[model samples]
Target: MGERPEGPGQGGAEDGTAWSGRAGAQAFAAVDAATDRLLGYPFVFRELSRRIGAGEVLVDYGCGPGKVADEAARRLGARVLGVDTSPEMLALARGSATAVAEYHLVENGRASGLADGCADAVMCNHVLASLPAEEAVLEVFTEIRRLLRPDAPFVLLSTDPACSGTEYASLRIGDPGEVYGPGDELTVRLRRTDGSWQEARNHAWPVGVLPALLERAGFRDVVQHRPTVEEALTVADAGFATGRAWSAERARPPLVITTALATPAPLT
Candidate 1:
């Protein structure tokens, strides 16, 4: 399991967990997150925008340094709450001029100080990769469910582990033909804004198994969508959509967005 909730490399035994200290936090804040920027987060915001309107509460679970949360707040006008297990990350997040409405710490496997069912919607982006077991993932889903009101939407943004070896703009998941089962370790390479690559050790959770897990965690209506470049042409920024050849991504889109609704609470 990952030491703290944030993006990959928050700290672990794999190679070197570079996402520590002020420098590491700054470096993480600077990651290009190319695949995410193009195909991952835009789709998440779109999904949230459809479900909730401006001023509603959106909890960004495992929000690393508040970049994506800030964007969601700015784009959708939601009161974004960023929660992470890492105090360092939360500090970095709070330091951002464009930080979200609030930053909260997650302690002892829960988002401390945030009330139950406080969110209108919740989005967990790439945080599951750090989990190494079904129970861990289920725990995350359960917590997310606890954060939502009855029937609130939970949008999970993840990378498809099967799309390995293919180099998209900024990410390469694993070795070619390397089929990864749930909880299998894999090396993911991410590009920085300055054009350098960094490796992170993460675990795989295939899209097929997520629905069942969500069901077991008190969620319903699980639907998964893989965003493609063709779709991005409509949803993404004009310049970004037409920016690159995006040949690899066009052929095999690695990003997956799983949307589910929290089941209503049982009667007392």
Candidate 2:
């Protein structure tokens, strides 16, 4: 992928930098509520939850607020570690996650302070777009590769080309930000609760091109999820239709990506 959109703590959202102090709080409340409903899809957790061994330590990569981590902890019986960049988001995540998860706030999404080969699994849900540079996403990928056991899995779900501008329009939610190539990054500007705009550049990738990236990241048994907007809508309420229209566009269905077993390949 090209460069990612800006990340949580970087760019215009610098420390001591406030987007919409009260605005972020309110919006995240709604975001967390919506995420609760969205996690119900079978494609969300069935395989990872069912397949991994009991008591495995899984990293909920880019765990914005640990919603998916909470789900994984609830069903898989696996211990979860939720990671993200926004302290406010992390604090909220700490509150929402079950006691089963070990919560943490990373200074950057590209780095999780865990030791090498420690994690059994890593999941990045809509996290790619959280950072503006492809380097950031790639760095996060490299970190996941480093921390997970050689044979572990790293599941990544990112924006499908058709739906990238639209689904992300939530932060902007409706605005079609600039589109660059896979290797490019998009810095998005959106309104916080207070009616002001903040920018975070996250990386977007076409659903079709994830495999090559995964391969380079040292992941195997890589899988891709190309759910149609109609299917995604069935899983969500009418309220999310606008939130997810990018998936509905034909010729480029925004996919829900899933990768497995981060088993390391031999060095060439």
Separately for all candidates shown, the number of backbone clashes (residues 3 or more apart, or on different chains) is 0, 39
Off by over 4 Å in 2: 1-26, 32-41, 108-113, 164-179, 183-203, 229-253, 265-268
lDDT of 1: 0.81
C-alpha TM-score for every candidate: 0.93, 0.69
Worst 10 residues of 2 by lDDT: 1-10
Q: 1-268 in candidate 2: lDDT tens per residue? A: 1111223323224221322243443343333223223332334555566557778997776565455677778777888887766666667667777644676656544444677787887766665554545566556777778778888777665554444455332343213755556645454444444545555444555556667666676667777665555654655455764464352243344446566566564223
lDDT of 1 at 12: 29
> How far is each candidate from the true structure, as Cα RMSD in Å?
2.8, 5.7
Predicted candidate 1 versus true structure: per-residue lDDT over 1-268, tens digit per residue: 1112234335322244646666766766766776777788889999999999999999998887888888899999999999887777788888882748998888877988888889999988988888888898888888888889999999998888989889989878877889999989888877778898777777888889999999989999999999999899889887988989999998999989999999997122
User: Native-vs-model 2 lDDT?
Assistant: 0.55
